[model samples]
Target chain A: MEKGKIIELYRKMLEIRLFEEKVFELYGQNIVPGTIHLYIGEEAIAAGVCSNLRKDDYIVSTHRGHGHCIAKGARLDMTMAEILGKKTGYCRGKGGSMHIADFSVGMLGATAVVGAGIPIATGAGLSIKLRGTDQVVACFFGDGAANQGTFHEGINLAAVWKLPVVFICENNLYAMGTCQSQVMLIKDIAERATAYGIPGVSVNGNDAIAVYETAEKAIKHARHGNGPSLIECKTYRHKGHSRFDPATYRPKEEVEEWLKKDPIQNLKRQLLEKGYLLNAGMAQIEREVNDIIEKAAQFAIDSPYPPPEEALENVYA
Target chain B: MSMHNGDGKMRVITYRDAIREALLEEMKRDNTVFLLGEDIGRCWEGAFKVTKGLAEEFGDERVRDTPISESAIIGTAVGAAITGMKPIAEIMFGDLTTLAMDQIANQAAKIHYMFGAQAKVPLVIRTPFGGGVNIAAHHSQSLEAWFMHIPGLLVAVPSTAYDAKGLLKTAIQGSNPIIFCEHKLLYPTEGPVPEEDYTIPLGIADIKNEGEDLTIVATMFMVHKALNAARMLKKEGLGIEVVDPRTLVPLDKKTIIDSVKKTGRLVIAAEDCKTAGVTAEIAAMVAEEAIDYLDAPIRRVAEPDTPIPFSPPLEKYVIPDERRIIKTIREII
Candidate 1:
């Protein structure tokens, strides 16, 4: 990859890390209501996969979806407003963090239900194939969702039809607080993809370049009408399942070991060593990002709440 | 097959023929409209023969059949609807809706709303409900009340042949998800339906028999029973008014209330289980809103809570017959 492209990817990863840190702080101060599922350690997976996608390519996200939205080019201020329950948000404050969607950018929508979006993305791909378009759909789900019935049905159907969809699984190793080992006997989730007669690969999720390269190949194969592929990214989350979880279920050594491979820090070090970003340049980028987030926070705080009567407005049609 | 104008009104047709005509007309009107279900296009002509000749007219792609997996059938139709196709999925039996409740209630009913109205799920789920055919409990059940509890869905129940065609046409053209409940016994029943194209708006109630002594609000097959009860009570010098609220979700409460005010008594009849059924709901609505206008306590003539039995005697004992409906109205008055 080019040095300039690598720096750009690093910058995107930094924006996501700092944005999530700010959201965590505001959530602590009671500025945002409702529960939130953070995407702190999963930044590389989103940034890497989305870097290879075109404007018309589609993506369906999970409940921990902010990183995917930002990486897919959704405006940070609008997404923040949505999280704060403001009318100016992507869904007019009706859909909070878990349900953010911008169809104009081909981000179909995020579903809070586990594995529900898989068949939806497959159906979208079916639409593309029927229209004779080369467009592909990238469906993102957690390791927990792999056990859902929709996962089996959706993947099998896509494989049989040769639909243009890339099933990206971010294997954070836990479904809520339960570890992956407790649920499945197999060590690698991608290995199950072979049962559906599809190519499956497990990649180092902490390495942005590896994830980007894997996703690029899978997406290219899908667009060329070869078939669907299952690409599992091995990663970890810095926070618990949600805002209320303290993550007591996980061991201390595991957390410590995974923290050492933080994708943002790894990319930052590579960019600095390669002469793509000097100390001054890094400081300027940090300042600009901070100012943008500050404006987003103010916009969310100032936006109005939806009218009470509007509750019954969108029930039908 | 000659068209006739009696009393300067459109000619009469069978309810089954009306439904088939609606499907034919809608398919011609919209290229995206398609049909899918089990034996829907078979030469045997559907279970009730509503989709009799559609397969030959539109070809196999437009009129398709499927394996008996209700979940897969409904789920695939949902998938088709969201991706720009207007699919009319048929659930062969109303009792079978239980097998696909998750897809119907959780997925189809909630997708558009959960996505913040970004997409419109224009799908019609048609099923035959009610028990009078002696087809036993598993095949014959009135489950419209179960769907009425959901918020983002429209429920339409057509009683007359004209309504069977008109309401269906309206449902196909509408953008929201619709649950079109047809009565199994009413398929071969005939009534006056226009030969030309026409549509009746949903959520509107039709007053079949207007009188002064008592008001009877019913749906589907029960509407015919209430009218029959009114005829039997006429010899006894009792006046009975019959109201059929075609759609259950957006119920025509105003029309029902107006009829009750004029009659000063109300009796509701339905083929569903007596407990928490459509009849009970209508009775409760009247008790809550129009209690002051009532000269007597509201009455409900409905099937017993037990399932419909295969034996003829047992089934007759369980469901509300015309005699039971008449007795209930007499007690109320």
Candidate 2:
């Protein structure tokens, strides 16, 4: 990739990492309400896949969806406001972290129900096909969702119909606390795509360039009306399933090993080696990201809560 | 497409055909409208033949046959609806809706509100719910009350061909998720339907029969049972009013309450189980709103808390009938 494009991807990854860190800080201060599933380590997959999509293309996200929304161009202040349960936030504070969405950029809302958004993303692709539009939908789910009946049903329908949908599975190796080996006998989640007669590939999710290149090919295949494909990005979460539970289930060595290969750090090291970014450029980007996160947190704290009567509104239409 | 007779005459058709006509007219009127379900295409033409000949008319693209995944069927419809396509999905039987409850209740019913009015789900779920058929527990059920309890869903229960065609057309035109419930027994039953296109609003109630001595609030197949009981009561110098609240969620509370006030008596008849059922909701509404107008305590006619048995006699015993309506009415009067 060119220097400018690589820097763009690096900046996006940084935004997600810094934004989530700020969310963790706010949570510690008891300002961000409700539970949160931080996307701290798996930033490459969202940044990589969403970088290739247009503003008109649709994406259905999961519980850990803040990274996806940010990559899809959601404003950091609104996302922070939503997490803080403010009236000015996306969804008017009705939807907190788990349900945040910005339809203006085709972020088709995040569903907390495991694997439920799979078929909905397929439906969005079906709508695109029926309308004779070239738009595509990126369906994001976890390795655990691959076991859900919706995974089978949703992918089968999209495959049979040749709908423009790319199923991206972020295999963090563990669903909450149970490891992947305990649930499935298979090694790679992407291999399950053969059952639906679609191409499937597994790539290093910690490497931004690898994920972006793989997603580019899969998205092209979908845009050309060939069919849907599954791209399994092998990665891990940096925190527990939610903020409350401690992830002691993971081995100390395993956590330490994965933390060294963190997506943002990996991308930064690659950028420096390829002469895409200088030391001063890297420092400049980090300072800019930190400034943005601080402002978003302040805006969220300063925003007002929605009036009690506003709850009764928007129930219909 | 010209089912209308230009000459002044009432065009009659079966309840199943009325629903089919509504779908056909709406699909033709709006290119965005389409249909999808298990075995609803050309080969099967729907399990109840409600979509007979539609696949041939609209082609496989518009009238699509889907896999036996109920969740995908409704979930995809929700996706399509939010994306500007009006998809009418069929779940074959209402009992099977439990498999897709998350999509229906959590996703479709809550999306627009949860998303801060960013989108509207103009989707319709058409299914048959009743106990007249000997399909047993897995197939026979009256689950309209379940959808009624959902905040964002509009539950439409059409007892006759007129209401079926009219309410279904309205459901197609409106921008909301609707659970259109058709009764199994009423499918083949014939009734007078107008040739011209018409639509009945979702919240309106229709008085099938007017009387003065007592009022009977009924829905779906129970409306017919209540009317039959009303006729029997009329022969014995008693007058009974039969009111069918066609749509349950936006219930015609005003009409029902006014009927109760005029007759000074109320009896709610529904095919669902007696506890926490449609009858209970209406009975409670009347009790809260028109208690002072009642000359006697309210009575309820509903199925007992048991699944519909396969045996013919047992099935007949479990389903509410005209005899049960009459007994309940007599008690209230």
Which candidate should be chosen as best, given lDDT against the real structure? Answer: 2
lDDT of 1 by residue, B196-297 (tens): 677888888989898899999989988898999899888899889999998998899999999999999988988898888898889888889989999999
Candidate 2 runs further than 4 Å off = B1-9
Instruction: Put down candidate 2 lDDT per residue, B88-148, tens digits, no spaces.
Output: 9999999999999999999999999998888999999999999887989999989999998
Which candidate's DockQ is highest? Answer: 2
Error of 1 at A242 (Å): 0.8
Provide a comma-separated list of chain B TM-scores, one per candidate: 0.96, 0.97
Q: Residue A185 in model 2: shift from native, Å? A: 1.0
lDDT of each: 0.85, 0.93
Q: Given candidate 2, what's the lDDT at residue B111? A: 96
In model 1, the clashing pairs are none
